[model samples]
Target: LLGVGVAQLADYTQEDLFAQALREEAAEQEQALEETEAEEEPEAVVVRRWLPGQDVRHAEFGPGWVQGSGVGRVTVRFETPWSEPGRVRTFAVDDPALEPARPLPLRRGEGMDGEGE
Candidate 1:
């Protein structure tokens, strides 16, 4: 079935493309309106500091390092070398449930070269 008019799609398509180009043009525009009530925004989105294999301890989940981080959150896998792999958990960047800890030792002969083999 025929929907909108032919010119409508073309006009709106042009308008939509113009809007997209406008947004891309304003990609770095952060100045507040001098006559408006707008407020200044943060310079950057966020800075995730957690790294994989880094030592970390959770209040209830014990200890684990960061598996990955994004969207103002971090994922962690908790487990000790002697035990099975730990469960994965995600928490806020400032969640009191987690804290940094010392790194763990590698498995037998893992750090050394092929000498162990």
Candidate 2:
């Protein structure tokens, strides 16, 4: 129906009715565009939670913990959503051996570790 109104408006070169219909159409389209833009927009703010036992390092303290802290330099906090904020530490991302460990166990049992029991 709206398209029909626009087509009719185009047919007449310069009539008051055609001009009015065009103006109405332009306004309707503008309103629809605004609604679409508003709906597509995301929230203004987002929050991320920290967790415990996860591997992490800071810019100064080296590698430490999922543990809590009390110092003023940094306050460690839990990374997961389930746990409370633990603590923050000022650590270096570059500790000599801060990289992830291998999937295998750190060491074998007495019999397994040695050549023979």
Residue 42, candidate 1: C-alpha displacement in angstroms:
15
- Please state every model's RMSD to the true fold in angstroms: 10.0, 13.6
How far out, in Å, is residue 6 in model 2? 26
Candidates' C-alpha lDDT: 0.72, 0.44
Q: 17-72, model 1: which lDDT tens digit per residue?
A: 99998887676353334323334544555544777667788889886778988788
Using all chains and alpha carbons, the TM-scores for the candidates as numbered come to: 0.48, 0.25
In the range 1-117, model 2's lDDT, one tens digit per residue, is 554556565657567787899999999999999999988998664322223444444434333344422232223432333334445544333333333212222244422322211
Query: Which runs of model 2 end up more than 4 angstroms from their true locations?
Result: 1-14, 44-117
Query: How many clashes does each candidate structure show, in the order listed?
Result: 1, 21
**Top-TM-score candidate index:** 1
Per-residue error (Å), model 2, residue 85: 37
Error of 2 at 106 (Å): 67
